[model samples]
Target chain A: MKKYLKYVVILLLIPLLIIAGACFYPERSYAFVSLIAVLLSCVPFFLSFEKKNNSTRKIVLLAVMTALSAAGRFIFAPVPFFKPVTAMVVIAGMYFGAEFGFLTGALSAFISNFYFGQGAWTPFQMFSWGIIGFIAGLLSSPLIKSKILLIVYGALAGVFYSLMMDVWTVLWMDGYFNIERFFGAVITALPVTVKYIVSNIIFLIILVPLFEKKIERLKTKYGI
Target chain B: MNSFKNLNPYFLISYFIFVLFISIFSFNPIYLTSGMLGALSYCFLILEKKNILKSIIFYLLIFLAVAVLNPLFSHNGKTVLFFINDNRVTLEALIYGAVLALAVVEVIFWFKCFNLIFDSEKIIFLFGKISPKTALVISMTLRFIPNFIKTFRSVNTSQKLLLKNHRLKRYLNSFSAVITQSMENAVITSDSMNARGYLLKHKTFYSRFKFTPTDLFLLIISAVLFILTVIGRTSFTYYPEFIFPDLSLLNCISYFSFLVLSFIPFIFEIKEGIIWKFSVSKI
Candidate 1:
């Protein structure tokens, strides 16, 4: 029962809440639904570490990775929308496991927003980056083994993040999921989306090898 | 002697959560106006005057952009305002846009206040009650950001001294070195915590915050007000057609209750100021 907890949460509870929200409270469902999704994501994150030895190591590593991902934004500030935050998050997921990846990605967004300024979009950003990291972790074996697949995943993650955020934008603007307005938003956001994908691909190509090598070394050294 | 800022973190968190959610979900002009006024006044009371002006101006720009841009994309509603490029810009759409813009800005301002009030220590305190490890991760990540940045810069400078040309490669190499160093540091950190018996079962945690009577009273009041406001919100609609609930005694009562709910923090702040002034005069 405990082992299947994550699947139950991610698949059953979240969808039920979203459907119920949409059915009963259409006007207010977006925020409530997404907020619930974000909170639910944290369940798998915390559950993954339950009763595990060396949990301290995992937590510290996650904190470092999150901090690195957040600071990565500052390092690439000279380049517009070209930060390696997504790359760091993907690498964390690939190395640490899905739960740590999710936590790192979410925390990085939440912490970095202190510098960038928090707003209504913060939760959406957190959910997007977090889910990206979580999925990356789930596919860690293939992602770590194949360079091509890793690069492809990076690009898709960028598009996915933008798409998730665009949902928020459309919902905010139209107060509901207006398909026409949503498409308009996607079109309007195409340039930034392209930039995001390109940057992700570039950073992944550069950083993944370095991160994987270091992580492999640490794993062997500490038996993590 | 207690003030708004001195309210229990839990109460403050609940208040902000209730108000922000309410502000975002409701679109009735009355609700939006009250939310905006409440957010603006609370900000003025808390933030420095210069920051207040800057944020007000920033939100004003966003408000104008939303107001101007909405009519271009959305061509709904009955009253046509003008036609640009054969697009019928409706007055109703324009008003809806303004309301949407105001809602966005109101939420933003409330978040600004939320961020100001809920600093890192308070966040850790709140989260710590649920999970100590989670709070530890938050606090550690917060600490590591500045430390990592400093390490990155020092690594970059040292690398710069060793190599010329290929600045991109140098930067990447320096960053790679920082990654390796941070990984090693992570190991050491975990080892140290392990040595100290972290992650032990039945671990005890400590916090400085205590729930006072004032906090309990504030929480109860805010929770009741929140329920009332939510009830009030259900009968109101803004899009497609703005349908406010008919002007009945119950509707008026709920509306005023919501207004009071939104302004609770501002009321507390003003009360604090008045009490402070009176005490100083006595002195």
Candidate 2:
């Protein structure tokens, strides 16, 4: 009952609340509920990892991956839309399982924001990257075995990432999810989305084969 | 008097929740007054004078825009004031807009204070209690970021010298080199931690923050006031007509409680100032 309660709230109560708020109040509840829902979904995964031991090495390795992605963000700051973070996070997900991958993606988004700036967009950024890494982790076998799947997933992940952020822009500008505003935001973000796809594919192609060998060596060496 | 930052994480988090709740949930004149006064005092105490002036001017414009915009679009109230472009603007709608704007401004001020209060170490400690491993990992990740940048710069410079004229290739190689090296370093680090008996005592968590007796007192007061404010919230309606609740005992009690709740940090700041002044005089 207790376990199901959170699902009940996340799945049922929150959307109901959104509907109710959207109907009555113009702007307030949608943003908070959506962001809260994204963040709450992450909680259970993190807590599950907390139960496991031999966690020190994994944590350290996760740290290193996160730093790499954040640093990748810094290195690519000169470019308009080219960032290695999503690709690296996808690779982390493929190699290190979903939770750590999520952490890498989320934390990189978070820590890197300390450089850029932090605001309402931070949670949305964290959620988008984290979810992409999570899905990559779930599809790890297919992602690793086939080159085409890796590139396709990379491109798709970029599209997903950019679109998710656009959703935030729309909800923020207008009170509700105005489709017109959403379409406008997406159209404006089209170039960035393409760049995202290009960078993800480019980095994945560069990093995957190299990391497979390195990570395989890591797994065997550390028994992780 | 104890400083606000020294307050326990639990109490601090609750106080923020309480204050934000009161600000967001009502438009009662009492609630608005307390929240605005509290927010203003805290901002004055904490923020730079120049920044406060700037934000006040900025938010004032925003408040005016929001209050004006609400009546233009929202034709919900009974007392029609004016019309722009054949749309009826109501006095009630204007009031609602002002309330909404106040709520927004108050919440922003509280959030600004939140950012000041919840530093990384405090955040790590608070979350660490919930999930120690993830907290430890997050803290480690933050630590490693600077290290990675330092190593990457040195490696980039060295790689640049060796590679000689492929800037992109040099940076790429440096990134990969640092990646591999960091993974190896993690192995050594984890092994060293294991040797030192890390994670053997899973039940124990170490944190720098201590919840002293003063925090407990504050926590009790916060909890009581939060409950009072919740129960004493004045019912307000703004659709057909603006209905403002009259002054009642519960409303006044909650208003006073919310005032105290919001000004707790400001109170601490003042007390600390006075204590310092007296100490200097005695010496």
Candidate 3:
């Protein structure tokens, strides 16, 4: 009962702190404030809880994961092709679950947007990245361990996110929804997709084998 | 809160539909202004009743700043108020921008109230089956963000205590530490969830919501009012009368009534809070 109560308190505190942070510093860039809030909020989980053996190594791995994914968002931008973020998101989702994958994707976008700027589009970005992460988790089954399956899934996730973001743009753009405009937006997004595919190719070519090997070592070491 | 349980789900859906309809089909200044005014007044009443005046004052200042500062880059309007070098600072643009800012703030406020009223449980109840997987994913994803945030804070402070000497290094170390901690936490959480057969099958769920006859009545009324509002909007020449957006006596009364109608929910909420306070005092 006590444990359950503690979880409830923690769950409630998260949104409250984010709201307080956003409200308290309205003058500061919202994107920057949000990034800081996300970073600052994670500190409690680290100290108040314990980790398994090789915690230090695990933490380093996570940081690298965040940096790799964050860098993917900036370097690749948004596209429909095999984006860097798609690969990373899929990898994370496969390893973790849908929830963790979604967080990773959303936080990556939120932090990156600080470098970009917040607009009427922040919620959409959150939603888009969240969708990608969710798909990654849903698709991450034992059969997906093969590189071909993972890459295929990553490509599909990229297309899915691009389509969702395109729909949002159509809604926000001040005009009647016509077939011409819809197709036009999709065509405009093609270059972004190309960039995404290029980045995904680069990330997957290197990161997957390395991560898989490391996880294998850890599993053997820990007797999982 | 109990009465809120009697509010219809379709009423909520239609509310969003009306919002989208207005935003898409109509860009009339009068319609926008009426919405702005209606929303603003309700927010005012809410703040007054809840004693959130200070927060509103603070946000208003920020709103003003964002509005005034934006036009330096977007100098598009023909009606120029002044000439700063070659560029024109137009009154039309500034006012347009100020209204847009107000609309943005109002939308945010509306969503905040919506969250308070409808909340996660209600959302799950409404849209769980058609897309149960997506709903579960969203709920869990929402859960992780706050969890990550809380853990990040404590871990940073502990790291700060250990590395007390260098300021620049402290910031870098903290950033790296957060990423590391989050990854580890994610793995542990995943492992635990997996062991419980989370992803293997459809998860059974339940909600705290109950539907009553009063809810049905409220739904019908809201739907009728919405249909009427749409008809009135399409059938009448409510604006563009040439003289400074004049409101006829009847129109003025109708708008005022609309404003009052919007406040009905908040008024009930404030009254409940007062009664609860009184009861507690007596106890």
Candidate 4:
């Protein structure tokens, strides 16, 4: 029952909330419900690690990864559109389970927004990074084994994040989805999007090998 | 001494949540203008003068970008300004873009205000009620961010002293070292926390904030004003044409309530300042 709880909450409850919010307030629901969804998504992840000894270890590791992802943004603050946040998130997802990855990705966005300034975009960022991490976790076996696959996934994750944000941009600007407007947004954001993809690939290519060995050692030593 | 900062963490969180929602959803120029003004004044009062100025300039640039970019894509209004790439750039699109810019700016400023008020302590206090473990993780993560950055910088500098030839290789080595060190720190911290019985049930949380009558009053007032503003907002529409409901007594009252809602924090800040000055002079 406890094991199933996570699946139910993530798959059922979150979608239900989004559907309900959209039904009631289409224009505003995305932002409002996305916030709720982000918060809701954290519950299952937190609940998943219930064992007394391991839970603490999991939580601490999560905290460290989230901090690393957030701090990674600061490391590349001088360079426009280049940050290891996505790469770190991907690495976390590859090592930890999907739930942990999602939490780290979402929490990184939520926490870092303290420094960057939050807006309607914050929730979208949470959702984008969280989902990217989730996907990376799902494909972890393949991604971990193949460097080429990992790099490609990293680049795609960048594009995916930008595309998700563009949805918010179009919705906020026009109060509804417009294909032409979205295309225009994509075109306008092309340079930044390219930079994001390049940065993700570069960071992932460099950081994955280093972090993988450390994560493997820790898992074995700590039995995490 | 009663100020916005002294409000209960829960109250502050709820207030910002409500205001942020309204800021994003409401397209009414008057409503957004009030919100923007309220946020701006609050920011001016709370933030350092330099930060305030920097943010203002930053917001203006964003406003211009949105304003300029909207018409290029939209081209929806009745009045076409001109055609670039055969798309009719409309005045309505430009205005919509500007309004969006205003909304974005207003929301950003409100969040700036939020960040100022809701530090990690306040956040942990608010979330701690729901889940202490989660709160602990959040606070720890917040603490680790700066610590990790500092460690990385120190590691980078020390590594640079040792290896001057291969800059890229040196950076990679430092980063890898930082990652391992931070992970070990995380493991040690978690083990210590477990040893300290952090996972024990029925942990007591000590918070400095107490919900007083003033908090209740402020909460009620804000809630009432929020509902009134929502009522006012629903009657208006901005798409295709920006229309206001007929200027009835109720509409006027609701509009005024929203204006007051927007100014509530600013009013509180000013009142607090005046009272502080009065007390200081008396002393």
Ranking by lDDT: 1, 4, 2, 3
The true-versus-predicted C-alpha distance at residue B84 of model 3, in Å, is 5.1
Measured with C-alpha atoms, the lDDT of residue B81 in candidate 1 is 70
DockQ of each: 0.65, 0.50, 0.05, 0.59
**Model 4 lDDT per residue over B74-177, tens place:** 76667777888888887778877887788777777787787778777888898788777678778888898889889888988888887785765665676677
Taking the tens digit of each residue's C-alpha lDDT, what string does model 2 give over B1-283? 4578778898888888787766755556567777778878877987789999998899899889767766764677899988888989899888878877776666677777777777767778878877777787778878888888788899988777776766766777888888888998998898898888885765677677777888899889888988888777487877798777777998888778888887888888898889988988998
What are the per-model C-alpha RMSD values against the true structure?
A: 2.9, 4.5, 14.4, 3.2
Docking class of 4: medium
In candidate 3, position A143 carries an lDDT of 22
**Which is better, 1 or 2, measured by lDDT?**
1
The residue-level lDDT of candidate 1 at A109 comes to 89
Any runs in candidate 3 off by more than 4 Å, and if so which? A1-122, A127-224, B1-25, B37-51, B58-102, B142-158, B161-203, B234-261, B270-283
Write one digit per residue (lDDT tens) for candidate 3, span A1-224: 98456445434565475456545643223433443444444433332322223233333333345445655444333332433556676677667665456555665564445444544455656656655665567667752567777666656666777775675544333122323445767998987875665556555655566557656755775555
Chain B only, TM-score of each candidate: 0.89, 0.83, 0.63, 0.90
- What digit string (tens of lDDT, one per residue) describes model 3 on residues B10-50? 56656545543443234344445555555545555544655
lDDT of 1 by residue, A151-220 (tens): 8999999999988888788767775566777788899999999999998999899898777688789889
State the TM-score of candidate 1 restricted to chain B. 0.89
Error of 4 at A61 (Å): 0.8
lDDT of each: 0.80, 0.79, 0.53, 0.79
TM-score of 3: 0.51
